[model samples]
Target: MASSALQVFGFTLGVLAWVGMIGTCASPEWRKNSHGQTLIDNTLKYEGLWVSCTAFVTGQTNCKDYAEFFVNLPQVLQICRALMISSIGTGFVAIIITVLGMKCVGLGSSNHIVKARIALLGGLLFGISGVLTGAAVSYYAQGVLQDYYNPSFAQGLTNVP
Candidate 1:
């Protein structure tokens, strides 16, 4: 029972950590153009607000993939002990840190309509990626449960002596 409690707590904490990371990473400084509508808000480069969407798609690099970072840390830390949720915490912090970097580049002049359309497109992408990431994590956790926590997978069978 105690172990179960611990596991439950850890999993709950992990979920929170993941969401927090995404939120932090996704949010950018609310920078507004002369028109004052928030050209760069919450780390989103509103389309008509396309500061540099091309830079993103070139594929040579990606602006700190927040979701991937959040999703991969927990498993890696199992190899050691000091990490202790650092993976999760780091993910959240990383996005927060990088947003500042991206903003420093500054956006080019884009119309409000273009920015709104871009923001809408970005929202769609974010939704799809978020769902895919969540599903992947769920599948991973299920695998862990089945392989390690399931009694039938281990030596729970009783001896017929």
Candidate 2:
């Protein structure tokens, strides 16, 4: 009925969100600004949680892991890395709880109220994880914006987006 359908829908959405969280955490384009655009000497660069990479149009790529220069990294990036990983853990917990609480599942069949409570708890956890993810992204984005608008950063830029 309606309850079962809604539960299925929520679970499906949760799965999608989990995938998206993983992508966001792993993406190297969280903050990027590239320069040059020719097949021979083009330079493409991007920064991620763990490393920063620069690629040449000749198919050469060089990456420097953050751990090597961890002390020099901005505070926001450090916080972002921690939050993203924690959010993934929270999302996993939510999915497990929701699946067990589903009506079609046999894990928690003692009482309807108990199952419902578990499902509600899962939903709440999803909300919490979402908030944490949002905060992390926003914090990093703000830093990027600040850097983009700063005079010192603009002084050496050539065609940035």
Candidate 3:
């Protein structure tokens, strides 16, 4: 009874994590202006994996997709993009495997041991997905920090907290 309960719990958590991965991928607030209340309070600048934008309190906003100038992009930005996408893909596969292996679903092997192994495999994939996400976010954060602190890099601008 306990084993089945654990499997259900793991599957639920994995699904939630997968959804979160997708949300993060779609979010445009990966980075934003450090000071929202600047002298030019009308404009707010922010950036994400795919695009960057500036917004005005008056409901005006302008955005631009990341340029295809891959060579000029920061290594951290490049790596983060790759890793974030990978995490989403891996998480998706894990979710499908987990669903098939679920005892209630009975879509795969009937043997308890086989089902358990499949669940374990899904769990492992979930773990890898989480690790990749952490690495990507951390690497990007490090770059933001370095740039923020270095006057020569950002001038008066700093990364959003």
lDDT of 1 by residue, 27-143 (tens): 332122122244323233211101112122223422332233333434422222122233344444433332222312235324544433433343343344445445434544455
Q: For candidate 2, lDDT tens digit of each residue in 62-125? A: 9877764346667877789889998999999999998888877889766888889888888888
The ten-residue window of minimal lDDT in model 2 covers: 152-161
Each model's lDDT: 0.35, 0.82, 0.81
Which candidate has the highest TM-score of all?
3
Better of 1 and 2 by TM-score: 2
A best-first ranking of the candidates according to their TM-score comes to: 3, 2, 1
Measured over all alpha carbons after superposition, the RMSD of each candidate to the real structure, in angstroms, is 24.8, 3.7, 3.1
TM for every model, in the order presented, reads 0.30, 0.85, 0.86
Selected candidate, larger lDDT, 2 vs 3: 2
lDDT of 3 by residue, 1-161 (tens): 23667778988999899899888877888887655465685478888877788887777899888776345566776788899999999999999888877787769899877887887788899999999999988988887777777876665564332
The C-alpha stretches of model 3 lying farther than 4 A from their native spots are 36-38, 69-72, 156-161
Task: Please identify which of the two predictions, 1 or 3, would achieve the higher TM-score against the true structure.
Answer: 3
Q: After superposition, how far is residue 107 of candidate 1 from its true place, in Å?
A: 2.5
